[model samples]
Target: MGLGPLEIGLIILAILLLFGYKKLPDASRSLGRSLRIFKGEMKGMKDDDVRSKDAVSTTPVRGEIVPPPAPSGDPNAQLQEEARLAELRAADLRARADQARSSDSSR
Candidate 1:
């Protein structure tokens, strides 16, 4: 039969009588500590589940058939920017070469 409050109280009283008042408090304190530890473990498990659910819902990998949007500044723009930078570098190198050659000729 399911225990009502009266039945539960009697069981608790019996336990207290068996263990004595001095030991009952200590036993209850240990039980409270165990319950707190169990609650903490359950919370951690729930947090991990939420994290995995969020990861699955967000962000895509490379090979998915439904491709992610191309990033801003397309390849053509990047290539043109790279070419411009190359030209600037080449010009700088040419100027340096000319200065060296002129210095040698003057000497």
Candidate 2:
């Protein structure tokens, strides 16, 4: 379900006839330049995307999760608060687990 060599040759022949031998070279040269410009623009867009991602991740350490700003707009304070809360949650869970174990042993 692809174009055979015969089909491809006929298409090329039709193009050459439409553009004529005199104009075909110029037309192909312009098409090549347009493709080159389009490729460069696509590469530029990818570079811009990478730059934007780097800008957003402004943390000093790579791959570190940045905590959202608190009401005071301090990133470090917000991170510390998040860490404190996480530690508290872990302690609560550990206490609950110990209580459960003690009850199970008594039973």
Candidate 3:
């Protein structure tokens, strides 16, 4: 048979007795925070999935010969490569920031 109101109340009373009234609020707050973080991460994963799909669509087919990155030994050439990579990173950050701003504004 299913539990009635009295049974449910007794179960709740047992829980309160086990955990105490003071600890319940702290435990619930911790649970809420954990759920919030979990939801945010799940949202981030969905966004990553969309980004990966876009990347896959744009990517070249299998068997294509992709060129390797620049050599590491030469100091001047390494500096130039580093500079180029830094610029690329800056551009990517700016683009993402802009996208975030636009999404925020739209929302």
Candidate 4:
């Protein structure tokens, strides 16, 4: 069964009471901006996924004897690069977990 009119009305009334007439519009506008930002980021992520897939297709497979594409820019650059990439991956994982938690909470 779906939410009847009464339930929907009650939900609206609850929201109105919580936000008050003056702040409601501002709250809704902020929500709209947030949703727009979220939509744009999701689109960007899809584009990035496509690009990464293309990059992966050209990358060497495991156990293949592939020479390094270029010499290190600096002696310690490779080590720093690896550490930076590892940190980025960890951050991505944390963001995914946080997104999952927020979605679950919203439901």
- Best-fitting candidate, scored by TM-score: 3
TM-score of each: 0.47, 0.51, 0.52, 0.50
Question: Model 4 shows how many backbone clashes?
Answer: 0
lDDT tens digits, residues 1-107, model 1? 88899999999899988999899889999999999999999999999889856744453322233334447758887677556655655565577669989999999
lDDT per model vs. reference: 0.73, 0.77, 0.76, 0.75
lDDT of 2 by residue, 23-71 (tens): 9889989999999999999999999889856754453223446455578
Q: Per TM-score, what order, best first? A: 3, 2, 4, 1
TM-score of 2: 0.51
Task: Give the range of the ten consecutive residues with the poorest summed lDDT in model 1.
Answer: 59-68
Q: Which one wins on lDDT?
A: 2
- Compared with the true structure, the alpha-carbon lDDT of candidate 2 equals 0.77
Which regions in candidate 2 have their CA more than 4 angstroms from the true location? 59-107
Residue range 4-104, candidate 3, lDDT tens digits: 99999999999899999999999999999999999999999999989966754444334343334566677888777657655655565577679999999
Model 2 residue 17 CA deviation in Å: 1.2
Stretches > 4 Å off in candidate 3: 59-107
Q: Compute the lDDT of residue 62 as modeled in candidate 3.
A: 42
lDDT of 4 by residue, 1-107 (tens): 99999999999999999889999889989999999999999999999899866754454433344445347577587777556555655565577669989999999
